[model samples]
Target: MELDPKALALFKEGYDKIIEGIKTLGFDVTDENFADTAARAAKGLHELIHDQTQVRKDVDALLAKTFPAKYTEMVISKHNTCFGVCPHHLLPVIYRISMAYIPTEKVLGLSKLSRLARLIARGPRLQEDLTHELADLLHVNLASQGSAVYIEGLHMCMAARGVGAHEARLVTSGVRGVFLELATREEFIKLVVAPPTTLV
Candidate 1:
């Protein structure tokens, strides 16, 4: 994707300031090895936060591809992995998402579910909010009878700072429609927690 010239200029200004800050920390910015550090960092961050509009357009296109389903069985997709930035700290968050939905008359393609999980995870966002957004998209956009999302997130802010709980993982869930039923919720939990089968 091409970067907007205005945004690139702004990012370059920010990187210049960041280079000055690095100098205060006693880093030799003039060093040959560090010469391009600021530019590389700015480019990396731009990739993470830019092109959100394109991502949304891709999501809309994905949602448009659906097939008719006469049955009401639940569809589950597990271990959809994605990376995101935490808005609070600008740190990375690793996510493993599992989703389930009971289709009414239409259902998204199986691969689309995983793609949707990754698409929604782009950019800076909170884990709790991300979980709910996935559930809402499936339930409302697809008009599913019910939708649920379970996420396991490893937040760099939690692991690299403050209390520094390196082993800690934040787990969050969201449910809509029929998934609010006790039995249905429990079944989703059971399936999500079950160990993956080993190939012979």
Candidate 2:
């Protein structure tokens, strides 16, 4: 969507004030290119906080293909990495997501699974919310007997502020349908915790 001219002017004003604020703090920003640089910075910030169209389009495309399930076995996609912006601080959070589903009637394209995960991770979101949203998406879209999502993230908000525990990692999960069963849940967890393969 095109931004309103009035709104753009207001945003430019805000950026100008930010430049002035830095000047008051003893940083010189009188260079000729400074205004252009500040404008770009402001535009980038606006996009990061407000833009969702591209990611939405990506998700729609990802869900475009489906086929009938031919087997009763589980399908797992593991250790997919993506990034999200934290709602509270607007800082970036790096995510490693693992997902699984047992197909009932329909199945989704395998590559699109990761694409969906990445799309959901694009905007300002909580890790817990991200996990459940992915699981729910699969449960509904695939008409699966079960679905699960596990997420591990390194949040810049926590590490860059507050008590600043640099080594901290956050983990969250969501499970639905048959995945709620103890045996099935345990099986998924075991696969997630297994050692990674190494190439010779």
Candidate 3:
């Protein structure tokens, strides 16, 4: 298959390091297995570190929509799951996102919210950056009066290493515009925290 010259070069460098690193760890990287093992390791690392700019653009084109002169109301989406690589350890961080917005002249389809969340969470990322970026994207792209995002993440970097408490989770939130209002913000918070029957 055709490949980018620069990327191929970088992959080779990484692949070489993988073989050497394993050999240094007291395991014999034999000639027979060396090529295959390095190729696999390099491919995995490239996938984890690849740029996601195109993915973001494609998701925006697929999802973002605007309509003329619409009434304003709170829009909320909950339980959107995100599987991302933690930049620090290259481990998975599982995220559940809940978001709310008040539309100005635009609103996104319900399914698109989940798509957007998924697209943004795919590469090496920090939960805080992911939450802030999602909120910002919604606020601008939806032309909304306000936007709020809440994220709860189980970081494998934390769970699998360091203190190693698997049950520990990190929660983060971001809000802009009318969501800054005490009551408006609380309304969004309550919706996420309350059971489905409360809203139904």
What are the per-model C-alpha RMSD values against the true structure? 2.0, 3.4, 4.0
Task: Tell me the deviation in Å of residue 64 in model 1.
Answer: 0.8
* Candidate 1 to truth, TM: 0.90
Q: What lDDT score belongs to each candidate, Candidate 1 first?
A: 0.88, 0.81, 0.79
Q: Which has the greatest TM-score?
A: 1
- Worst 10-residue lDDT window for candidate 3 reads 1-10
After the best TM-score superposition of candidate 2, give how far the Cα of residue 12 lies from its true spot, in angstroms.
Answer: 6.6
Candidate 3 lDDT, 94-133, residue by residue in tens: 8889988898877777788887888788778889999999
Q: Rank the candidates by lDDT, best first.
A: 1, 2, 3
lDDT of 2 by residue, 1-200 (tens): 34445545666788888899988999778877685866676565554444467566666767668888888788999889888789888778888899999998878888889878877887688899999989988898677898999888999988787585877889898999999999999999889867567758
Candidate 1 local distance difference test against the native: 0.88
TM-score of each: 0.90, 0.80, 0.78
Clashes of 3: 0
> Cα lDDT for residue 172, model 2?
94
In angstroms, how far off is 30's CA in candidate 1?
1.9
lDDT of 3: 0.79
